[model samples]
Target: MPLYYYYFGVLNATLLFRTARWRPPLLSRHAARGCGHAPSYGKMAARALVQYVVLRGDLRREPLSWPLGALVAQACHAALAVTHAHYQHPDTAAYLDQGGSMRTVVLEAPDESALTTLAETLQQNSIDHKMWIEQPENIATCIVLRPYPKEEVHHHLKKFKLLK
Candidate 1:
């Protein structure tokens, strides 16, 4: 026998699915609703993982006119570093398993101070991340949080805007 609880809105849908006690029932209902049958239970882990990258916007102006690609490289470095550091963790493994579906949200920070402040906040909250410091020149470029279920970290990032 299975239990069913119905609630409207996206948050309710997530709550209904994420409760460990009710996960399988949600999966069955998901397929019944034509979400397409998942080949394995792992495929039904609908947590929606994400890695957030915050790059310093000052790099784009005045004294330093780094091209867009160069700034992007900073984000890439941080993301790869953090992912590698946490490769053995469950969420990280699930994110990598997502392959083509992996999601990364890049946002712009005002300057070094802002990036540093945000890093401190994450540290205080026990959120692990990699803050990439450009070598040779040795400048803090960007920070990347290891893959996490969006809801776990979205509130900390709500203030940032997507990088344009």
Candidate 2:
């Protein structure tokens, strides 16, 4: 003969039984509360993981007529500089940890004035960024914001459109 006790609600009402060759199975209280069911972010990570790259659209317009590739290179430069500058940041690490799937939104500003104005707005809001100045030319051609959760900075960038 064996004695067995059971509880309902895992912790409340109780019942006792005595039966030969019968036993209560072991169970953990914490396990029943879904302790091991936290959401897993493997492969497809969470959203809002992006960096914003803004380049002057005028480079490809008017008499300047810079090559399309040249403008792309400027954006790349800013992206590299900003990422390097903030490599130790948690958001930056998460962004890069995405490996080949790293995300960046390339936006276009109409001209240097537009770029400068956006820079001012970002500065006013205390957002960290790098305004890339090309050497010899000494021009503010592109800007890159440190990797951030999109929701944190999207409003400031929403007015701009994709570079291409």
Clashing pairs in 2: none
Task: Tell me how candidate 2 scores on lDDT.
Answer: 0.75
lDDT of each: 0.78, 0.75
User: Of the candidates shown, which would achieve the greatest lDDT relative to the real structure?
Assistant: 1
lDDT of 1: 0.78
Can you tell me which runs of candidate 1 are displaced by over 4 Å?
1-45
Candidate 1, run of 10 with poorest lDDT: 35-44
TM-scores of the models, in the order given: 0.72, 0.71
Q: Per-residue lDDT tens digits of candidate 2, residues 1-164? A: 32333356342212332334322221132234444422223523655577899999988887889898888888888888888888766676556655456678999998999999999999999998999998899989998999888889999999899988
> Candidate 2, which segments miss by more than 4 Å at Cα?
1-44
Q: What RMSD does each model have against the real structure?
A: 12.0, 16.8
Mind giving the per-residue lDDT tens digits that candidate 1 earns over 36-150? 4322546526678898999988899988878999888888888888988987676776666554567899998878999999999999999989999999998998999998889
